[model samples]
Target: MENPLTPDALLAGVRRTRLVAIVRGNDGPAAGRAALAAMEEGFQYVEIALTTPGALDAISEVRASAPVGCFVGAGTVLTKQDVDNVAAAGGQFIVTPSLAPSIEEAAGRGIPVLAGALTPSEAYEAMNRGAAAVKLFPASIGGPGYLKALRDPFPDIPFIAVGGVGLDEAAGYWGAGAIAVGLGGPLFGDAGSGGDLAPMRERARRFVALATQYDGRAAAESLR
Candidate 1:
């Protein structure tokens, strides 16, 4: 069955949820399981990083089994071939850790692409090159304050705060004007280490609750 969420809808959903689970499992099965677990805890967006082993297969598995309205995307995508492979694997979107021409390919296919950028120049360049959004990588280095400052200029550009974002920091990113936060180890933990998933599920729930709380706050502020 075809995914019901379109590129624009996917971006809107990310903004609505304000949380994206970055799944980097040790293998395909682990990645799929982690994605399902995150979804079970109310995460509507999931990004399967290509750096993971068998990531393409993992994306296919997660997309096949994900429930309706769940958006599954490919992350850490670096090459044009990677973008095409992700599309072939049923990925609904694309996320790269750096600026790349492959972003145009994803956009050409009507897949929303979030290209990484740390500076205002890079962000503008990314948007000009057809990125649906700009992902602030290693966001912890500058933290929410940095993101907040970046938003001052590019008020219209959607920003996804990725890398080193903890569960407790998710709301801070939202408050900093980020459209969404991408969480990896802090949310999924080392699921590949044969650890218990119950704790991870609990963390995921907490992250969702915090994100939703912030989303409500943002909505209220908009009304004022």
Candidate 2:
């Protein structure tokens, strides 16, 4: 599963693991440390939010420090320039907060992207425009029920439930047919800002255990 060079391989791994750690912080070094900590506890994919101070530096630092198979990526990516910068920094993937030009830009560069999309129009558009997956942002608005409804129409599009996703909500997203759950504060807590890594690791362990129990996209479709 190292590198996950192709979209199918990358998203397949995501569907199986069912969790992605989103690291956002005020300090780059602190965020890097937190990302490494998450990887140590079984997180294969980690995204460092570009909103953090010196986020590219954090991605570079984590990408270098991480073990060979672990993939580090950049999130909140907004433009083609952001895509280029993250690729230069050794980020293996790009995650946008909305349907941005970066999706096609990243695709053209052979980089997979989790493009954020809210409404059904955006979701369909994101998929047709080369997004590796559609990120359901602020999923709490409609919760699992809304996701289930979306799946009914776009069963082929892989969905990554993001924004406001916590441990308790993780199972719901999985059952609703999300290929993965992208978590920020709930998973990182204050660790990215130099808070207790022990608690973060413990949370990671709990989330991983919970995620593995759900059958992800396949199970949801079968049940439908």
Candidate 3:
């Protein structure tokens, strides 16, 4: 069955939210709870990475519990089978750590994909291959300047900075033209430690505030 959420809608949601909370941990239940906490704190997009133990089940759990209009997607997707599994588990989107055939597979199934890329060539290739957006992995290494340079030539391609994206850096990436920002450890914290969720909620609130502020500023500037 085709997902009710279309690629265009997913893309628009990403642009509107501008923050993607990446949930990963050893305990599936904890991961699910963390996702819920993030959603409760106003994050509309969540990616449950396959690297987490029982991540598929976690995805299903979060999907079943997340409020309406929230997007639950599968992260670390590497194969066509992963795509099928995520779709079966009610994932509305796919996020890969690298540019792969999986992007094409997701596109074939009408599922939007954000494939990871580190260079201009890789990003462009991923876009050409049907990725809904390109995730600039380990973005901290290049920081916002690198993303700005990448956008210089291919301004049309949507970019999502992931891997090492701190809460403080969210606005910088948005200002640099990123459609959205993906955060893992910085957002969820060490889920393995069984820490309190209050910190996560605080972090989520901070990120959301920064993204909203920058997004509004950009929109206002566009009008002028």
Candidate 4:
């Protein structure tokens, strides 16, 4: 089924995909093709880095052609102008490597922002500034253990783990309480070199399975 759902619904379903594939392919054709591949693997959320050539146009075209439930967003956004551009392109969300007040302004207009942060303080500030969810960039350096430590202190805040994350790492992060995972090379996996997508799809499937298991466990624990 081609979803037939709204962007808001699509964004929510992104938690299910547990895979926000970041495509940094420099042109529209490659970016679009890569996005389609992710969607084919059951990934509903994909991010196009603004640093990529024609990134906004890629977002627009991808949004128009994406499956009904696909949630297309822009990454590497640093300013309110970038946020505006994302909204203008019909992007479902805005993700930044760092938090900016302009991102907050955009979030006020009903666009979701995944403001990136490294420390707990930055995460708190970003959330307070109206970020829909916080992105823990360079998570590879921090690792799942880092996310687990953060959960110890800030369980109330929502976080999306990014950077250096692989499909195989999904279950551990979910166990640590990540709301979603933002992946660049691993999920999108070498779009320029035309990397095979089979691994990516299998990874996505693993995430979906893990999330379902976690949901069930959470429910069971809640009833106890």
Give the TM-scores of the predictions, in the order they appear.
Answer: 0.91, 0.93, 0.92, 0.83
Candidate 4 ranges beyond 4 A from true positions: 1-11, 192-224
Which 10 consecutive positions of candidate 3 have the poorest summed lDDT? 215-224
lDDT per residue as tens, model 1, 2-28: 555566887788888888888886777
Backbone clash pairs for candidate 1 read: none
Better of 1 and 2 by TM-score: 2
The top-ranked prediction according to lDDT is 2
What global local distance difference test value does model 4 have? 0.73
Worst 10 residues of 1 by lDDT: 215-224
Better of 1 and 3 by lDDT: 3
lDDT of 4 by residue, 139-189 (tens): 888788999998788988777888877656665676677878877776666
lDDT of 2 at 216: 45
Residue 213 miss distance in model 4 (angstroms): 5.8
Q: What is the C-alpha lDDT of each candidate?
A: 0.82, 0.87, 0.84, 0.73
Residue-level error in angstroms, candidate 4, position 52: 0.9
lDDT of 2 by residue, 1-224 (tens): 23455676678778779888999988888999999999999898899999999899999989888976678999999998998789888898889989899999998877888999999999999998899899999898899999999989899999999988887778788888888899899899988888989999998887877776565432322222
